[model samples]
Target: MRAEPSLPRHHLPPDRLAELVRGEGGPETLDLLLGGERSRRLLLLRMLDDATDLGPAWDLLSEAQRRAPQVVDDLLMYPQTGMWLTTALRRLRGRTPMDEPPLWVELGHMSALAAAALRAEFDFTIEVPVRHGRVPLPTLGCAVLPETEPWTRATVRAEGGRAVIEAAGAEVALPPTTGSAGPGWHPVRRLTVGARGRRLDIVLDDVDPYRTYPQPTEPRPLSGEAAAQWRRMLEQAWELLLREQPKTAEAMRRGVFSLTPTPAGERFRPRSVSAGDAFGGVEASEPDDAVQLAVTLVHEFQHTKLGGLLHLTPLLTHDSDRGKELWYAPWRNDPRPLEGLLQGIYAFVGITRFWREHRRAAPAQTAMAHFEFALWRAHVATAMEQVHRHPRLTPLGTALLDTLRDHCAQWLAEPVPEEPLALAHLCADDHVARWRAHHRRPAALRPSTGPYGHGWTGRADRPAPWRPNPRSCPTPRHAGWTAWRCSSATASAARTTTGSRSTGPRRPQPGSAER
Candidate 1:
């Protein structure tokens, strides 16, 4: 039998960083992993920037880089900002963030900043050798944020071992000292929330927010009220996570370092993206309330945890031939793949439970809770049913589905109010019916007597061919019912495979903002 690979007890242990490096027990795993050289605990604390004093370290690193010059390379090589960027880039790319390119970017920026700090020059540039060519440090737009302007390219002119960056009609000055916070902090904007544990970093990401999502328009910086609202909601989310979801809180404490905030009303609500993004960091918008944000956190964390586990093990066999067919997802207006459906099942399990608990804690909000509970529970059940039918599910995937079903048992059984229950039933039935209509092949029709009991002949005993009236058929977006000219059609022909009467709410149009 193959034995489990032995792990070493080192400063940066392999186990916790597995999510960071997406370790699969490969030879390069140790090299790629963040922690054997730097202490994992210290690194997390520094990123969190709450418990320990990183100011001194930042100053020392700056001084070292100034004196030795090579110290900048050493500082940049360490995977501190790399960990947060790993998560951010993965989310941006919809895949694992490439290690080398981002690392190069980090090195260039750090070296440039170091050069700026050492000299008293208002403008200086540092060039680092990249894959294509020697790219200057501190490029106009951020690596993640894409922008356009009159000046397309930026160039750096080096003279007498000193360089200057010239771009877009203005010269940039050296950034403020790295005393407490500034420049050297790079990717993360750490804040002390004055909360217990002070574990997770609530980074107000300056660089990533612009590029994190495809903005409705160009993502300008949040203004006064909007920025304050974002910060307040974020602190509240942290407190709520610590209070309600202790397990998730603990996991996030270890894994997440960055929380990129966006303005409200973005497509695809706050989600933990980048499957192997171990930074536990998720991109979210400032919600109307902290309670909603807490729920979003719980839901997305489910995806983050599952994404990490899936990367390590094969939960479902890769099916390239699955084509582009979109399956029905009640939670979303758009169709989804089996994987997206599975993600919904697991996420809604937590969302339902959140409302289940909310039903007791806040009586005034119980109605809304009951509605969400019934809505998501029914939807998750429908999704779970679809999941079982997926042929690609591996044993691990089956196990995960079983666990989700188990988690949802309590919420599924809990009674909802009649109004919300009816609504939930209507919505679920409508979605399922429409889905079947779109996918299922119609059954062959048998000859029947006409409405006036007339057959093909004048004999009443014989049957007659009939077609459905156009006015009677439902629209394509509604029930997707075929318009047939039939004079004699039985009610049974219209019934669904579930024996459900083909009567419910009509399907909402695709862009009706259903979710």
Candidate 2:
């Protein structure tokens, strides 16, 4: 296995990392770690070194502090406070350089943060009113770094239609514009969809667009032209949901109550994200058309449902001896863990299903939809193959895999056009080739036995059989299609004829890579 990055200097050392890992690092350590920039920076680097550009990440943090300066003290009071947002930004931008950290890394960090909160024993959440509606608030972290050098300690609460902060023998009301209650609390609009019996309030929050998560994009409310565009998009999305994906539409009706409308930097763009069950809402940007928006809705809601399921049961069993390795996900340029790969399959299953239906209703979009169905179905089937080969799943996890596998099987069995099938196979071949180049060693040179294989060493461009057997690529055997085979001679001839002046494997284009 490859060695990981070293720890940052003048900060948390190996012993300190052990302390944290062992749960021995308590309040004193938290205070010390939070008091300076070094410890916090080190913790973030450890969690995200592979995926993030450290300089750009810090630049984002500087902008975040500028936007919400009040949180600076809070950041210094908790070791992991600044990371949640910045790491989220990194993931949103697909900046992860390698595989994501294991689930425990994040779960442990959040648990530690929760444990250190002054209000944890009370088990409560603060609610602050924002012009149109009240939002749930997180417990204010320790107002003072207790038992440390003398520092200001304050508590914020809503009283008499104003937010008052009481600290160190003084009381002051915070002006609404300067300070916010905290992250995750924001003003939002309620969008009630469907009829009386099935009515659901999808809270439309434009706040994500305003946040610094994407960087360079400052926070701004939806208004004037932006607001008008949002309303139209929502209406169209709602209509498509009711028509195309009734079950997922019902999931939205039952499981989702909040919708955050993030701004699309460009027109005719669709963006949708869900931060798991902990953050109970879907954040989506305006889409080019209702069909795309409908697909985004289905994709995110699947994540919301699975996120909740994850809290109740373990999916992948923990194995201490096994190192975390990145796998090739057809949709992403970087690698993903088994868990992240599983989540991607879950979300895209619904998306593939959406395209399965839309391919018929919208003739103009049929080609694209057919292609999407073919791509996602094949990828999902491939992921199921990986899971089956690996035995690190719990009983419940095995059951969950069965359910998803069954869904993929049915989808894969659906008849697809030959053009779509060819496109999907080509994409699979490209992704596998890239993965082999990045992670695996080349096949050893061997004497050729075939008629045209004379004196040939194994080279990707030569008529060599790829490990994935790309030329004789196998689709699901039960899917009623014979394995698609391209003659090695033909493949080699094409590469030679094209003189491709290879720039290297192509990185995924924007809008082409989905979460």
Best-matching candidate per TM-score: 1
Q: Give the TM-score of candidate 2.
A: 0.53
Measured with C-alpha atoms, the lDDT of residue 480 in candidate 1 is 23
Global lDDT of each model?
A: 0.45, 0.47
lDDT of 2 at 52: 42
Candidate 2 local Cα displacement, residue 134, angstroms: 16
Worst window of 10 by summed lDDT in candidate 2: 477-486
Pairs of residues at least 3 apart in sequence or in different chains that clash in candidate 1 = 12-35, 467-485, 467-486, 468-484, 468-485, 468-486
Please provide, for model 2 over 332-368, each residue's C-alpha lDDT reduced to its tens digit, 9 standing for 90 to 100. Answer: 5455567777777777766777777877776544545
User: RMSD (Cα, Å) of candidate 1?
Assistant: 13.6
C-alpha TM-score for every candidate: 0.58, 0.53
TM-score of 1: 0.58
